[model samples]
Target: MPRTRIHNMNISLDGYAAGEHVTFDAPIGGAERLFDWFDGRVIHGVDRVDAPVTLDRAVISLWSQGIGVEIMGRRKFGPQTGEWPDDGWRGWWGDEPPFHTPVFVMSHYPHPSIDFPNGTSFHFVDAPPHEVLRLAQEAADGRDVRIGGGPSTVRQFLQADLIDFMHLVIVPITLGRGVSLWEGLAGIEDRFTVETVTSPSGLTHQFWNKNGHD
Candidate 1:
């Protein structure tokens, strides 16, 4: 069966997924102090990230290796030209994002298709979580589907208990305040079984799987 998973989700010790104020300059919470966890080595599968690709590049390629499409929130996808009052910012990935498969961004806004230098193509959807998941599964073919994040979207799928499995890296430092990833986790016990833990350096990795996505 095709599974929906959220992997390597980084969060702060104080429960902040991102810093309080974010601009292009401060995308991942100061990009240094708030994200010291990022510099740590990432182990993909049984091997560490030894590829020549950037971390973001590896994130897309490695995670989707056997997965369906990737899903992101409107905020994560950024604003399109003539699409927002503020400065028009496309995805941070520039012309060649690593995702070769069709990418789905969940939002109310729609723009013409974004064709990247690589075969990667992005599609904007006004659909809900379930609808997007269905489309992602198809795009994934028989592979698994992945829900990539920016806090709010993760909360949506986690709230509905639509996720199948997860891999988390609990970093060492703490953000006094910022966007939290584990908030609104009130009813997940009804659908998930939290299991397994690994201590790697200062970071702790945890895994969880759904009882079933019925």
Candidate 2:
């Protein structure tokens, strides 16, 4: 069955998934170090010539596997707030977005959909989590829907019990003040079967499969 999944979400040791202020200059906010271990090449199936495929790279490579559509928060789309300006800003990613699928961006403001030649299209909507998920699932056809996050988006899906699988990478750093992933999700592990794996790069990868889901 097609499932709702979250992948390659980097969180700090303090449970913060993103920093306090997200600006156009700093996309992930001040928590940039959380993704230091990430290699963008792996997402496109590129391998490093200097070294063999490591465990971390192997896991990160699964980010786009089986994903047909993505749902992300407005913050993940861009650094705009309260009525998008007429600046004609497409998105953080230029013409060719990494996601080669239909992406639904959650936002309160309405905007026309943007399409790219690489099959990446961004649709802006103001619906709740369940409604958005329904739209995404429909666009996904028979494939899985991925929840691309900025923490708040993922939290909403978790709160609605709409996520079937999650892959969280725990970096060993602590951001004392930032957007947390476990804010109101106390005892959320009870709903899933969690497994942990520590990579040689010191990143702990946690896989959460919703209970009763394969």
Candidate 3:
């Protein structure tokens, strides 16, 4: 069976994953409450040799090195601060982003194409969500295609039942108000199955697989 890794490009806590409105200023809501989840790497500049990210460093490293192709929403790609004027704008990650594979961006506004110098190629698609996933999957070849998302995008795909597996590392913080995983998801009781869990930094890494089977 073919599977995709639906994970976050940026992460937060259960509150953000389970919140109401995910915005730039409030990207990860209630994340402060998740210090128990991230393994203690809570965005501090402090560097420790023996210490990992202290913030779900395991999951972060997996995200950085595991996938080949990635799909993201335009809002997640641009400044979570303001509206984008044209297609000429690239992502905020700067010249040499960590992503070097093909990235598919979903957007309504028709903008010109972009080619980054870091071996990363950006493509905009107005096609249906499944179609976009299909294209990205194809581009990924053997490696998994990661679903990089903002809350809204993840919700859309989740509603469509397209996600296969996900690793949620709940950071311990709270935005108080911001975007959530779903507006009407109601519950995921029947959709996902917990595979494994690890605890660190007051944070717990919840690994989930789609229903019925792995």
Which candidate wins on TM-score? 2
Q: Give lDDT tens digits, candidate 2, residues 56-141.
A: 88788787888899999999998899998888889888888999999999999988999999999999989999999999999999
Q: Tell how far residue 122 is off in model 2, in angstroms.
A: 0.3
Per-residue alpha-carbon lDDT of candidate 1 for residues 1-214, written as tens digits (9 for 90 to 100): 8888897777767767766555666656452464464544434443455555553424423565576578987666763323554444557776667566678988776666677767677788888899899888887889887787877788899887788887666667876777778788856666777764544445666667777555
Which candidate number would show the highest lDDT if scored against the true structure? 2
How much is 111 displaced in model 1, in angstroms? Answer: 1.3
In model 1, which runs have C-alpha deviations exceeding 4 angstroms? 29-34, 40-48, 51-62, 79-82, 85-88, 187-190, 212-214
Relative to the true structure, candidate 2 reaches a TM of 0.96
Clashing pairs in 1: 17-179, 68-140, 68-144
Model 2 is weakest, by summed lDDT over 10 consecutive residues, at 41-50
lDDT of each candidate versus the true structure: 0.69, 0.90, 0.64
Per-residue lDDT for 46 in model 1?
32
119-207: candidate 3 lDDT, tens digit per residue: 78888787777998899888888778778776678778878888888776555565555566646677874789876455555555677
Better of 1 and 2 by lDDT: 2
Report lDDT (Cα) of residue 47, candidate 1.
Answer: 45
